[model samples]
Target: MEPKHKRRVRYKGTHPKKYNEKYKELNPELYPETIEKVIKKGSTPVGMHLSIMVDEILEFLNIQEGQIGLDCTLGYGGHTLKMLECLNHTGHMYALDIDPIESVKTKERLLNKGYGEDILTIKNCNFKDIDLVSNEAGLFDFVLADLGVSSMQIDNPERGFSYKKEGPLDLRLNPQKGIPAFIKLQELNKNQLEQLFIENSDEPYAKEIAKNIDSYLKSGQLISTTTQLYKIIEKSLSFIPIKERKES
Candidate 1:
């Protein structure tokens, strides 16, 4: 029997604006043109990643066949794929990622692309466990650690990495391992919240945002979703003059 064809999802606008609705971005392998479309905007494709600075890193490393390497952050496995090619199938590449959900998908994707377990090994753990990895795999000839949140995480609304989305305010690198961001917000007092915003993000409206959040939490109001937190931030900053808001 033949496979059934699925129709594209409909949206309000001509082009899909919602992350989930962007069929091209959400399925880039099936839409090659979307590659340049996203790259021009300096954004990774949704549902996947295009590793940055590949040439620079490869040139600097000058990897050779038969040499072992470690990719401390697998992400969507883009960088690891390129590095594995430089090994020319003669050596091994080990990678780590904290996100169990995405990492398993990534391992499968890489395998489908002809990089099997013989050449690539993926571990689900924090990179700080390098000591443990080294004890098992021996010292690496070279290492690559991309220290940042993956685009897959940012674009997936369910992960709640972006405040623009309508998901829960999770804000966790590993959703299964940590308390959600909403809980943390509930725990912070106004002054502590102010300092957290200032020290962590340098948010200019730290004082105002913190004051409002503290009041809301104290009043027993809930803020469980990304949209709720975003509204609070907007309400806190509404005191700015419209002209001033546009100017700055």
Candidate 2:
């Protein structure tokens, strides 16, 4: 009997790089659908924002035709688009976002889909400034504010929100405004850091972590990236046994 030879199997066609602008531009029609698929599979596309619990949100809002609405965190216009559909050309939707890049793109996308200023208006501002925009645009019958950071923001490494990705330590919702989280960490004293972790995160090891972080900052070992900070956190928790770590 002849010895069987190992055969190498290769897949054809180049796989598109995740979040590649060229891929999105080349496959304009397929891009949005691809984003939906990714979201359904429990993962988010790098630059695409998925609206969560859309049906629930719409049902809860009890949107009616000709009723004005406001979408405070218009991440990628997913919610805004649905609201506009419900409005059915009779009402206007004012969408606000702090992300200049995504906001402009979403506005253009919505406009391309035939939603004009008569029915849709996009504003480049934080929801915290909603009072100003609302006053200018007039009152709204329904308002939606997605308070948490969108998946798009967290997935984009350049925005620096994920510890898994290697990026700057920035955690600001608006990169153009305010100092990044790394700088903020440096500015905070041990007490402030401890208090932040305790109040904001309810971390059990807040005091220990804050002390370590303060020492590192004072010693010029700057935690400038998410990975660096993540490492510090891992190291801080290393003393705990693996079995007990979960409860901690």
Candidate 3:
């Protein structure tokens, strides 16, 4: 070839990267309608949790500017975010989550949204130890504890919280602290299992389900997954006809 070919130069700043970190915050107009759609559909967007009863919570708390508060279950930081907005970046929020993975991610996300430690402080600890943690952080004006497994935790099969999902039977709120659900199941006797189910969930078929699960454990068939436990429960109740089944 007689003519020399010229190489095209690419500008890094002009060309958008494959992953844009600021897209979520920078594009505010896109989310209002999207969130409304999610609310109407009664489904949370993937990787996001819709704060339950937010208006009620905010009203009850009546968080004023420069007031300190504690959010005991900071699963997806939805409640924390709302509380922070109410505080108007002047007050401090102590957020607690047993899930370390989620806590870190939420902390970083909030920080990216212009909230620093001065505004939001996250603790990777159980709310059961709130007395001790709160003492160190000083007194709080308002405390909100939403005690339940969050949507994010249940949605992720790897965390092993959902009965519908086929995942490990690890239901410990703090995976790092206590024994997994499978081990706990193996340790409990039929009576203990029945009592647990009755007290915790008020399952009508608790006794039968407990007996089946205990038998399975005794037979050396490890009930280590959600589906396995689900099958055991199903088999235990299979004798009852669908027509005869009463809602608990």
Of the candidates shown, which would achieve the greatest lDDT relative to the real structure?
Answer: 1
lDDT of each: 0.88, 0.82, 0.81
Stretches of candidate 1 above 4 Å error? Answer: 1-23, 40-43, 239-248
Model 3, 1-248: lDDT tens digits are 67888644443686433222334322333477766776689777544576789999999999999999999999878899899999998979999998887788778778888889988888888899899887888899999999877766676666788776588899876777889999999789999999999999988888999999999999989999988888888899989987676642
Candidate 2 pairs with clashing backbones: none
**Highest TM-score scorer:** 1
> Which 10-residue window of candidate 1 scores lowest in summed lDDT?
23-32
* Model 1 TM-score relative to the real fold: 0.86
Give lDDT: candidate 3, residue 194. Answer: 97
lDDT-wise, the better of 1 and 2 is: 1
lDDT of 2 by residue, 204-246 (tens): 9998889888888899888999899888887888888988988
Report the CA-based lDDT of candidate 1 relative to the real structure: 0.88
Between the candidate structures 1 and 2, which one is better when assessed by TM-score?
1
